[model samples]
Target: MDNLLSSYSPDFPVASDGTQTFDRDALQERIARVRTALTTRRNPHGAVAILADNSPDWLAVDLATAQLGLTLVPLPLFFTPAQWVHVLAQSGATALFCAQPQQGAALGFSAMTDYGGGLLLCEAPARGGPLPLPGARKITFTSGTTSVPKGVCLTSEQQWEVAHALHRGVSGLGIKRHLCLLPFAVLLENIAGAYTALLSGATMICPPLAETGLQGASGFDPQVCLAAIERYQAQSIILLPQMLQALVAATKPGDARLACLRFVAVGGARTPPRLIELARMHGLPVFEGYGLSECSSVVALNLPGAERIGSVGRVLPHRSVRIAGDGEIEVRGNLGHYLGEAPAPDAWLATGDLGHIDADGFLYIEGRKKDILITGFGRNVSPEWPETALLGTGAVAQAVVVGDGMPFLSALIVPATAAIDAAQIAAAVGLANRDLPDYAQIRRWILVAPFTPANGHATANGRPRRQLIQQHYAQQIASLYDTTEHIA
Candidate 1:
């Protein structure tokens, strides 16, 4: 980590958001200051939990713990009250540093010394809990695909490797100003977004998500995003597929507001090629990539010169990818430790995702291994395969394709805009169906309201909770089949 910070000049700007600034030197000193304060009041080598919005103090706490050789557990801002309790008790976190002033009472902890960004340390009762990964330096919880979120333990080595590789990969692009669009707690942004920018001597803008025009995970205001780009003149930003889709929908052709963007990496979920093309048509330099938390966020990315539109781009130099016999993507060389029961030593991690590397080494992800829908016609399909095509048709904001053991595929479609009617959406679905084979096209669909975490229809990161969504819309889904049968 020292080597990473030292690579760029100390005077280089590490981060800022108009008002506050942290040069390389200042950031290193702040980390040292935070470490000193924590050590005076607490013991060394204990787990320290931090719950806060993105700020310089968040970075300071992260670096302080890493420097002190203490475990850092970051709790996401989106977690429910019950979900947050589960993590705190599950991870065995004894101390907490919260940036929000009232977080202390909410989490039941008294105040400690203030960090640079007005962050206060909070005390918590230490209940003995098993360490899923015994020697893990960091624990990041999943966004609760089920009712409980899984904690993934990772060492500093794995994180630094991803960050260094990211810096090396995008060095040639001359990325100077990077606006962090996602939560700093998100591993994707922590490594690829913040670490990569600092390592490459770029200025990282760490502002509140609301300031950047984002509300929770599902809400977005494109004009706010555009204004941020114009004001900060950020050369690069990271986004999910849904965010990119929103931007393209709101933007007009030849819009020069986004002209400052050099590289826009979209991942979190599968990105449709039409979405990428639509972004390009509006002069947004969007590139598609794929990754998950277990692999330490970034696995493959489409760089500036060597980009594949449909594929998720070439694998990083630090990692190796091979397809398993079951058609799952097996990743080696960069696999991190899972919080519970470590895998066999040096065993290849089988990513539940189904994908294959192209002849040129670019990866094309099909969909989740568990999500493969086998139609009654004896044909197998990846729901994401048709879903991507459907999303590309610009008719739906969200889609879930289901046809397991059924005659043909059917979907629950959320109209892209409130103004768009079922007829317009039907036409769009028809356009998507043209590109697919007979068995893979959408045979039936029902327009519905958007899926959100508040409604128990999706995860915090925007992944559809298949079981909950299926159950919540059980009646409508059954009607699509013209049978009163449940999707058992």
Candidate 2:
């Protein structure tokens, strides 16, 4: 904490929520109060979990826990109730800080005291034993496509190094104000977005998700988000690819309302090259990057002057990227350990992604190595590549491509709205197929319901669970190969 605090000036603003701004001194006071409360209020061994919206107080709790060398777990509001129960029980969290005291109590936490910024500090029943996380300062759970989310254990140094590398990468851009678009529970936004902003001496503007037009897991309104960007004069922001697509459609050519934006980082999913081009055409500077929770946060990012359109940009100085014999993208770096597990035996972490590096050192991601589909004709296909095209049409809301060990590819598509008919979906698929290869094109498809986390068809971040979806719709998928009721 001392080393981290020295990086920030004493009087400069570091955090704000549109109503209050906290300078270094004010922020330090909050951290001290939290530290004092924790030391005097709870057991010394168990972990503490925070369940609240994005606010300055949440940042304070994170800093305080880091200073005390205590384990802190951040819970995502987008998770379902059952997920919350699972995390609390599995992590054995003895304390919680949340906006709603009643909700915390219902989850087996009793109200102890009221922390500032409308957060209630509560305590839970004692666990049977110590937490499984060793030498871990923070435990961030991944919103996996499966039913259960896994916790990634990270030390303070690992997270700080990633933030410092990110600060060094874009220090010349002079991004003074960064708006928090994604939830801070997301490791990408927490480490790369907020931590990097603090290291670079940039003020982080944090607003509630509702205020920024984000609700639940997958709800986003680009118009409301654009209003926040303009209202706060945000010079830099991070977004998911789907959010970027919506912003591109909302902004007109040479839109002056978004003139304040200088750097927009898009990641958390594969971004189509056309979306990046479209965003630039609308006067928004969108840079694509890539990373996962296991590598801390950001591994590579496209800078202002240095960028490759289809690539995720060059690897950062802190990490090294190499391709395996099977063409899997493996990263050699100081990675964190998985919760309740031992350290990795190997030096390089196999990132389950298939990609290659260019001569100039830019990294391009093809798709998930496990999600790749092999056809009967022995042609390898990445569903994400074609799914990106299908989503680009703006008429298809959700799509899952499945054709492993089959003659041709097939898709289960959900239209943007109920007003869209079979003819509209066929036209959209045709438009998407025009750019794809002959073997990769969707020869047959069926209109289906939306895929969501609540339905076990997708992750909290909205990435489809291919295997589970395939198992659930095995009969439907089999019928697609048959000659009956073909829509496309």
The alpha-carbon RMSD values of the candidates against the true structure, listed in the order shown, are 2.6, 2.0
lDDT of 2 by residue, 261-327 (tens): 9889999888888778988889789999999788898889898788999899999898989999988
- The Cα RMSD of model 2 versus the native structure comes to 2.0
The residue ranges of model 2 lying beyond 4 angstroms of the native Cα positions read 3-11, 416-424, 484-486
Candidate 1 residue 61 C-alpha distance from true site, Å:
1.3
Clashes in candidate 2: how many? 0
Report residue 167 deviation for candidate 1 (angstroms). 1.1
Q: Compared with the true structure, what per-residue lDDT tens digits does model 1 show for residues 18-127?
A: 57888877888888778877787654446888888887778878877877777888988877778788888787777788865577557755645675545787765444
Best by lDDT: 2
- The lDDT for every candidate, in the order shown, is 0.82, 0.85
lDDT of 2 at 458: 78
